[model samples]
Target: MRVLTSTLLVEAVTELSRGTRLVRAKEVLAWCDRNQVDCQGAGLKNQALWDADLEEAGGPHRLLKFKSGECKQSRVGWALIAHGAKAREAAAHLGWRELRWTGENWDWLGGEPPPPPRRPASREAPAQAAAVRG
Candidate 1:
């Protein structure tokens, strides 16, 4: 099985928030647990696992964005996606275009193109940069 990171799941939901789907919180929680996510301190405080939210939108009744911690956020977005929450609206809120789910894996549909490939320095740039900085 291709294990998914919590970040990926969150990003996927953010991407898929345009299809009017309502995903349950429990489903997301279950997926996180199965994927060995360390959510013990990842927020999600008192909300029930069964709570449903529109895939990617943000509101009190839906996927409310909470300050998980210093520069971190919760995976509540996954719950929203699993429940088939509104994808387009949610994607708008998340600044994504579309979402894609294959009943197991989720990903962005139409968003920023992937990052450029990394190329190893010819054993020169790194040393030169370091030397220049030093």
Candidate 2:
């Protein structure tokens, strides 16, 4: 199985709808435990298993990114991408107060934009003197 890092998941979340994209880190771990897929087993439910600060999950690529906070969900915090809370980062950055969890199926929100800067008038023309001495 490919390692599931936040970076990769971030890209995945960008394209996938919240219904299909949201996968909590703990849920994944629990699934793995139920299936006995990894040798680490349920013991892998420790906090040190994740490293959100580095943009990579600790082991096997499972990771998460909470609201302006470090990964506390067993090192890998469970999360939903594009959800109101999760999408807040991107929405807020775009100056939008809210964003619908619609991935590719999104509509525009009335986000206020800053005004453009004004340039000062140039009183003098640019220097363009050419010498012709052949």
Candidate 3:
């Protein structure tokens, strides 16, 4: 089984987004299958793929059906707001807000925490300069 990295998936999604129409998860899955991209080793299953689609874009803007045909849609992930680390950090930094799986929408957390405090200036250099001046 070939291992597919999240980076490759991100690239595929980015490329797909450039087209006029919204790309379906199944379509992306088919592309990956044709290319022999395996998810088994990567710990990503069909469910995870579905989750990714929801996270990236709130769906039935896209869809996912199991071989069994069980499916649902909602707003998912922070993909619309930000991708990858930035998205994760945004979710983390925003205190009360959670990136929810709405099946058709991404709900941003309402409140955001203040940015981290800046460090103080170097005391050692200032002290040394004071001594030299004296």
Ranking by TM-score: 3, 2, 1
Identify the superior model by TM-score, candidate 1 or candidate 2. Answer: 2
Sort the candidates on lDDT, descending order: 3, 1, 2
lDDT of each: 0.40, 0.36, 0.44
The residue-by-residue lDDT of candidate 2 on 1-134, one tens digit each, is 33444454444434343443344445545544454434231334332223221344333323233321212322222334336465445534433332222333212233322222246755543322223321
Task: Quote the positional error of residue 100 for candidate 3 in Å.
Answer: 4.5
Error (Å) of candidate 3 at residue 124 is 87
Best by lDDT: 3
Q: Model 1, which residues run further than 4 Å from truth?
A: 1-6, 9-20, 42-134
Q: CA shift at 72, candidate 3, in angstroms? A: 4.8
Once fitted onto the true fold, the runs of candidate 2 whose alpha carbons sit more than 4 angstroms away are: 1-20, 39-48, 51-64, 67-134
Candidate 2 clash pair list: 4-61, 25-78
Model 3, CA-based lDDT: 0.44
State the number of backbone clashes in model 1.
22
